[model samples]
Target: MTAILSMLPPDWREGTFLGRLDLGEGPVPVLLAGGTVHDMSGAAPTVADLVDLGAFDPAQGSVLGSAEDVLARAALLSPVDLQCIKAAGVTFAVSALERVIEERARGDADQAQAVRGGLEERIGGSIRSVVPGSAEAAALKAALIEDGMWSQYLEVAIGPDAEIFTKSPVLSTVGSGAVIGVRSDSDWNNPEPEIVILSDRHGKAVGAALGNDVNLRDFEGRSALLLGKAKDNNASCSIGPFVRLFDAGYTMAEIENAKVLLRIEGPEGFLLEGESRMAEISRPPLDLLRQAFSEHQYPDGIVLFLGTLFAPTQDRDTQGRGFTHKVGDVVTISSERLGTLVNTVATSRDAPAWETGISALYRNLAARGLIGGRA
Candidate 1:
């Protein structure tokens, strides 16, 4: 458990911590370091109290004050609001597989070819998207057809409106929080350790931190037409503890090899657990984000998820009906230096049941893929 300090400059035992906190009014940016906390409300106020505050300047700095001086009983809602988020596209092969399985469950016979084309058009080659594949489209085609895991992903073709390899970063609004409130009983939710970077006005990644890029599996199956339904939801996106600033001297490649781990638990036991590196990711984080920023604007600020690697192929423990996340499943996504984002599973409002015959069938197939157990 190396402290996050190692990721910052040696002179400062801890880099200036920036995030949002609830100080009665609502959520506002705040800083924590050396046993003290500073509020940034005077600079950028809450989303509800937003005014013509110009632009959110992370460098405008914070107002000096102690948490006790303000209110000792205040909740720590310190992860600052990034005006927009560019939801990551398929940056991992495993994720691609997950989408394919989802379409297959939806009864797409050409799912494999569709997924393969997405790999070529949206993700393949630096000229197109950031999930770099060979310049020779044939190479990617060969790999998809020859690789067993990939072959399985292509069993059903991707729908015309799939979100796999779109060059631009997709807009998303889920924010930082401790609870994930899905909308369905069959929400196949999984947490992945994602490194989120705050973009400068020019779209360069100014800093990074640990993130939980929550995914709801049910939506990916319902339709490939749009990802907003599957990926974006209330309290689904979260990042925090603090942001480690990235100065010009430092390069995004420095964190490219960082280790990320995912862990999920129900009353029964661990459902998903594994470790992977940013190196395993096909899309370059900065490039993926830069392209996304090229089209979108965030006067306040924006957070970009790099994408996920490993996740359970199927559902795990539950009370009775085999919906993925139960009422109290705990999920922890972590980075040794950046720390962890732990959240509890809960649902928002009463929702219709989606774990009917088809969902169960897909879950069983995914579970069978892990027959020998977790790798």
Candidate 2:
């Protein structure tokens, strides 16, 4: 087992710290403190686990044993129930590279260049001030100096197949053990959500966690008109190590200072690495919360992958050197505040089949002004 390190609240460590672990007896909730595990077997057997117990307060129980002893015996479940994992659509972009990549993949050179030109022009590059026809015709500049690029991205919905296409956050699930299982090869996916904001029954932001909005680049590259295929799938998303509940004592400065580091490694060596600040996120966590539930509802709890600065993708210069994960690959998104989320790559064996016909319908609808953005 690879080691996962995160700051367990020092205060909670004395007595109140709690988590659920499977000790081969079955999945049991445990009270953790001082490197010890307090037995919660059959204890939560009725109203059951921590979430139902509310606040994770441990009922009086005998000490289970050393933390290592118990952890060694059990598998860790995601800290949150994860009824559904939702992504705020297009919340951030390193540049316009997302669409640019997809457009180029379609073998449409002019449109691809147009996408880049439009973005570069918005940031006021040396590119003719008028729209340049060729990559060489423009200076191609801008350093994320302006927030306007991605600040107003409209949230969209994600569906596993084309049938549920809509401009709203999509929901995907992870399998047991919090694995982001997928049928595609490793390099095909990317993760988002520099900050994972958690909300309660009323959709109010309540806690924070580390999350991976796993994306299948193959699906994404096929068409920008639809993100559902690339966005949602069984075990395509995962969150946790633990969640950091929001306290009144926490401040905006602390939130703004949060840093997200995306790291990936294969059987040989490091592959991709990038860092960004929470403040760079177009929608603040709180603001994203408001946008997320504006139309939908989550009675249990909701997870919002706020956004990210840039994704670690294949180099734009070399088409073949693209980004994708393979078997045995490990990807980790770490944050001091939210902790660390780690996933080892493995292609899902029994995943289901999905259709892409709906994307074409969505593109048609978008062009007719029936929906929000275009394809």
Report, for every candidate in turn, its global Cα lDDT versus the true structure: 0.52, 0.51
Stretches of candidate 2 exceeding 4 Å from the true structure: 4-18, 29-54, 59-66, 93-97, 100-118, 121-179, 185-188, 248-253, 314-321, 350-375
Score candidate 1 by lDDT. 0.52
Alpha-carbon shift of residue 18 in model 1 (angstroms): 1.2
Give candidate 1's error at residue 328 in angstroms: 0.5
TM-score of each: 0.67, 0.67
Candidate 1 lDDT, 1-375, residue by residue in tens = 222323223333244455555555444555545435665555544321122242334345465565345435455442544346555655665666556556655623224334445545543342223224333434555555565434333322221111223212222222233565565644465666688776655575666777776666666666755456555555555566566555443347656888888777786765767776788666667666766666656565566777766656443533321235676677776675565666676664432222223234234324534122332
> Whose lDDT is greatest here?
1
What is the lDDT for 97 in model 1? 56
